[model samples]
Target: MTGLLIGAIIISFSSVMVRLANVPPDVAGFYRLFVGGLGMGLFLWRMGKLKHFTLHIWAWALLSALFFVGDFFYWHRAIGLVGPGMATMLANFQVIVLAVVSVLILRERPTAAFMLAIPMALAGLYLMVGVSWADFTPDYRVGVVYGLLTALFYALYLLSLKFSLSKAGADPLAMACAVALLTGVLLGGLSLGQGESFAIPDVRSLLALATLALICHAVGWFLITRSVQMVRTSLVGLILLLQPTLSFVWDILFFDKPVNGLEIAGVILALVGIYLGSLKGKRGK
Candidate 1:
C-alpha cells in the first residue's frame, strides 16, 4: 500500500513533466514509450525473465499498443488545450467508460453504485465545462472532447491488456514491456509521418523526458503493478485517485491554473463518481 501510494504520487508528475518537456505531444509520448520500453526490456533480460513471447500474446500486445497510441494522441493534445489539471481529470473518466463497456459488451449487470455514478460524473463534467458551452473558447471545447476520447481509448487499452494477461503463461511485466515497445514503434513512425523532429531541444527537456520515462513510466508502474496485487480493489481505486487529485494540485501550484469554486466542486464530484464506478460490487446477492 505504501508502494502504491508512492507510485501514484510519482505518476502524478506525468503531466507536469510533459509540460516541462516543451515538445510535440507525439514526441513526448514516443520518448516515454521507447525509452521506457528499452529500460524495462533491459531489466527483464538481466533478470532472465525476458522469455519468448507466444503469438497470442504478441497479437494482444499489438492491439493494446494501438489503443494506447490513440490514448496518447488525444490526451497530449487535450493537455495542451486545457491545463494539465483539467485534462488529467477528464482522462480519469476511463472508470466510467469501463463500467459502461462492461454492461454493454460483457453482459454484466450494473451495480447500483455504477448506475448512480453515471449521472454524477456527467453532472460534474457539465459543471467543469460550464452550463453554457458557447461561453468557452473553441479550443477549450475541443480539448474537452479530446479528453473524453482519451478515456475511451485508455479503457480499450486496459481491456486489451486484461485479455493479454488472461492467456496461459502470460507474464504481466512481459506484456507491459511488449506493449510499450510496440507502442513506441508505432508512435515513432507516426511522428515521422507528421514531420515532427525527434530532437530534444535542451538539457531541461532531456531531463524531463528521461524522468518521465524512467521514473514515471518504469519505476512508478513497477511499484503500482507489484503493490496492487496486495491491495483490495476498492481501496486501490480510491488510492489511485491520488494521481489525478495531486495532478490537479500540481497544475495549480506549478502552472497557476485558475480554479473557481464550481470547478473545484466539479473535480470533487467527478472523482467521487469515478471511485464509485470502479467498484466491482458483490455477486450472487
Candidate 2:
C-alpha cells in the first residue's frame, strides 16, 4: 500500500514532466514508453528470468499497449484541456467503471462503500469542472468533448489492464516489461500517425524524461500491481485515489500553482470519494 502511495505521487508528477520536457506530445509519450520498456527489461534481467521470457506473452503485452496508447493520448490532451484537477478525477474514473464491470461481469458485488463513493466522486468532479463547463458555451465544446473522451478512454485502459493482468498470470515485473514493450510499439505507431519522426531527446530533457518513464510507468505500475495483490482491489483503488491529490500537490510544489479554497474542496471531495471507493463491504470483491 505504501508502495502504491509513492508510485501514485510519482505518477502524478507526469503532467509536469510532460510539460517541462517541452517536446511535441506524441513524441514525448512515445519516448516515455520506450524508456519505460527499457527500464522494465533491465529490471527483468536483474531478476534472472530474462532468458525465459519470450514472444508468447507479447500478445498480452500488445493488448495492454493498445489500451495504453488510447489512454496516453487522451490523458495528455486532457491535462491541457480540462485542467489537472478534473482531468485527474475523470481519468481516474476508470476505477468506478472497473468496479462496475467487476460486479456485473465478474460477479464482484458492489459494496455499500462503492455505492457511497459514486456520489462523492461525482460531486468532486462537479466541483472540479462544473463551473468551467459554463464558460465553454458553444465556443470551447470541442475541447470539452476531447476531455470527456480522454476520461472515457482512460477508464477503458484501466479496465483492460486489470482484467488482462489478472487473467494472464505473470510477476508484476514481467507484466511491466510486456506492457512497456507493447506501449513502445503502439506509441511509436501513434507518433508515425501524427507524422512524428523519432529522434534523440535533448540532454536535459532526456535525463528528466528517462527518470519519469522509469519511475511513473515502470515502478508505478509494478507497485500498483503489488499493492493490489496484497490488498483488496477496492482498497487498491482508494490508494490510487491519491493520484489526483498528488498531481495537485506536484503542481503546487514544482510549478507554484496556487490551490484556492474551491480547488482544495474539490480535492477533498475526490479524496473522500476515494476513501469510500476503497472501503470493503460485507460482500466485497
- Top-lDDT candidate index: 1
Error of 2 at 40 (Å): 0.9
Q: Which regions of candidate 2 are displaced past 4 Å?
A: 83-86, 136-147, 197-203, 232-235, 256-259, 278-285
Q: Which candidate is the best by TM-score?
A: 1
Model 1 residue runs over 4 Å out of place are 52-56, 282-285
At residue 172, what lDDT does model 2 achieve? Answer: 57
lDDT tens digits by residue: candidate 1, 1-285: 999999999999988898899999999999999898888777678778767566776787897899999998998899899878888999999999998888777777778998888999988988888665788799999999999999999999999889768863578878888898899889889899999999999999999999999998888887887789899999999999998899999999999998888888889899999999998754432
State each candidate's clash count. Answer: 0, 0
Across 151-197, the per-residue lDDT of candidate 2 in tens digits comes to: 66766766676666676765657766777777777777878888876
